[model samples]
Target: MNLKDLLEEEKRVVINPLQDENPPLLVVITEGSTTLARALIYRILIDETFGPNQSIHFILYDSLNFLAFLESTAIEITACAPNLLEGISYSADSSIAFKDADVVFSIGRARGYEFTKNERRESFFEEYIHVAKIHGEAIERFSKKDVKIITLGYTAARIILQFAKSIPPENITALSLLTLKITAALIAAKANRHPSEVINLITWGVNGENSLPDYRYAKFRDGKFVEEEIKNDVWLKKNLIKGVRSASGRSWYSRSSAYALADHCKLLWNDTPKGEWTCMAIYSDNSYGVPTGIFFSFPVYCQNRKYKIVQGLDVSENLKKYMKETARIINEESSIALNAHR
Candidate 1:
């Protein structure tokens, strides 16, 4: 019925169905401004059938606009699922938010309609990077050691790389599943099939403009090879990346992106399909000749809350060159973030 009640509930232990022993409540700390945080929380609540090793506990953290965020989010949740109020709470304190957290989701920041590209980038680094560092340090110092950090938003991929020293690279992942989902939908549209009918669509590179779609392994879900109409290499080469980038820029993107991110998290919480994999941005270890120590999008196989980068599928010389270029751009962005932090 209240935030206090939810906070109280957070201290209760629950028996894990997969394990005989009792575990502390599943603590999810989400950091962002109003819109993204709202979408993420609502999507997660509606999709309660999946997530983490234990029961879900949500802590919404909005430092700059906690008053408005707290009011609006509470109203939204009450309208959506009043009964679930016992599982959600709001926090303005980073320590309280991150304490004992199992998963950390860092998302959007406030942006103005008139901000220039360079201005937005500057603001993003100033706000998001600082917030990410706070979450990183808090998670490292207070939360579970093996906690997973999932980030989404415009430059979500670049933000987490700033946490290199605070969180293990493997524990931090940036969700670019939206890119893969869009790619699948675009390919499906070519054949007049629904997006879900496409399988194994992968992305290589960073999350933003530099991200590349790799359809070489994509196929129809019903065990049929993708028709040349659906996989039209020439058409894809011309339009796929541009279309995806444009889609991500549209006003309604956050809602769809949030939905995809929630589903992707579910896959991480449970498992991807027996033979299928998903795409995500994780710290690169030179997979496919990407340089080490930068976050890049790649095909990842997820199970039991762990993921392994899918390795050793062939990359064409052209794709390899493009991938390397993407890595370079991300690495440069990472360096800029580092410098800005300094």
Candidate 2:
């Protein structure tokens, strides 16, 4: 065999090793509010709720210290685990951290609306594109190392709320509300942005079909909640900025709520079904026909220790038009995120 081919063959052992020989967990979180102790505790609780099992080694990657922080962090996780165990293990050793690890929690911070909520908060547009770029890089790392089999986490909703607040409420329709509901958790905690007193948003997936999703959203506006189509392209184009959310400028998002959403999503990643679904916003590729690649929010499902986009459902022309608009946003951001370093 050629030297290059021989080297490539050696790398195969590290890719998707057998379950029995791999680490059971790896959660990647930044400490804007989340900490090592808090992160570990969340894992224990999620395992209990969603079957992370008591017999798995969980790895917490401290983005602050990277892997260098593993030794100290593992001790902390270990101290908290015995009294906390149904049957799980937490470790710092690099060798076992990624072995058999079926879950990867890639979470980071956002540019909060606390800085300024009402105006045309378009500056954050590029900030979130940067986050998208980071996640794109992350997907490549996970795919190569196979550290996670069931990756989990939720997207920041600050940007979505900023845009929603910009438009005329009357021009807003069920479609905009659906977008809002999918991202409401992030907005609910932000300053000056709570699920509207006049308009509470609601969403659900059709049996877990998020791609071409069989889903619907309703707004509690005008004294009641109802689902209706929005046929205004000009309005949609103006208020909706494609690929424009996720930032970490200033604090406003509820700390406790962010913790809750992150943990709940971990449970969802394990396929523990909740009412309607666990809300998550992530990048996408060729599901709703928004293009080949770019991130967008949709209900997703994980089963039998693996995940698949909830797919093959019909989308209305109006919603499809909005979806394409989001696609355009994502496509532009993809370029910015990928090329920012260059």
**Best candidate (score: lDDT):** 1
What tens digits encode model 2's per-residue C-alpha lDDT throughout 229-254? 33444322332222113222113433
- After superposing all C-alphas onto the true structure, candidate 2 shows an RMSD in angstroms of 12.7
Q: For model 1, how does the per-residue alpha-carbon lDDT over 244-284 read when each residue is reduced to its tens digit?
A: 76665454566776787678788787888988999877878
* lDDT value, candidate 2, whole model: 0.36
> Model 1, 283: alpha-carbon shift in Å?
1.0
RMSD of 1: 5.0
lDDT of each: 0.66, 0.36
Off by over 4 Å in 2: 1-33, 36-40, 43-52, 63-101, 109-145, 149-251, 254-269, 272-279, 282-285, 311-314
Off by over 4 Å in 1: 1-24, 49-54, 82-86, 110-121, 153-166, 227-231
In candidate 1, position 50 carries an lDDT of 53
